[model samples]
Target: MALRTFLLLLLLLAAALLITQAQGIGSSASDCCLKHSQKAIPSGVVTSYRLQGPESGCLLDAVVFTTKRNRKICASPTDGTIQKLMQHLDKKAKNDKNKKKGQTQRPRGRAKKQRRQQV
Candidate 1:
């Protein structure tokens, strides 16, 4: 009789825990917001965006753009919308550097008749 009573008690405890966990999940599904964007994407109106999952949540740290046609684009910004714009500008700089590197320029000093092998 004592063994049966102990087993019943354990079952009740497990049921209670399961009920509480279900309620918690329901509340989170309704309350949590993820991947929020702003109407005026160019004016820098949006704030923070994050991705929520079963294990953890992480901040996007960028500006997300939405067009009238409902197209989505992600812009890089470590902090805010302006920062994302800065990131784009930095990318332009890198591209310019790459273009300059690829161009053929006259050598200042005596050079080999053959061009160096490119990797």
Candidate 2:
């Protein structure tokens, strides 16, 4: 009986380890998994993200995002939604680029106006 119990415990442990590793918990996904990772959404493409992990895992409560930005910028499982963050960043980047271009180009504010309206 003792031997059988010991063997069972060993088997259980191995199974647990196998499960953890198979889920990519401590590997490359770990950097982005429970810890949060980002990628640029790129122009003309919608970004999508979701956390992957066990039910009791850190990502169980994670909120997925559908936005544009090829990478993850900042994330907090409790604070903000990922979609809002990406949209905010995309807006900021677009504004910044427009400002820079405006400074470079002739004061044809008319063209800038058109771009803003289209956006």
Best candidate according to TM-score: 1
The C-alpha lDDT values of all candidates are 0.55, 0.56
lDDT of 2 at 56: 31
What's each prediction's TM-score?
Answer: 0.35, 0.29
Q: Which regions of candidate 1 deviate over 4 angstroms?
A: 25-31, 41-54, 57-119
Best by lDDT: 2
Where does the lowest 10-residue lDDT sum fall in candidate 1?
43-52
Point out where model 2 deviates above 4 Å: 1-30, 35-80, 106-119
Residue-pair clashes per candidate: 0, 10
lDDT of 1: 0.55
**1-119 per-residue lDDT for model 2 (tens digits):** 99999999999999999999887767644433344444433434444445444553544445445455554433444554455655665686788889997897667446543445554
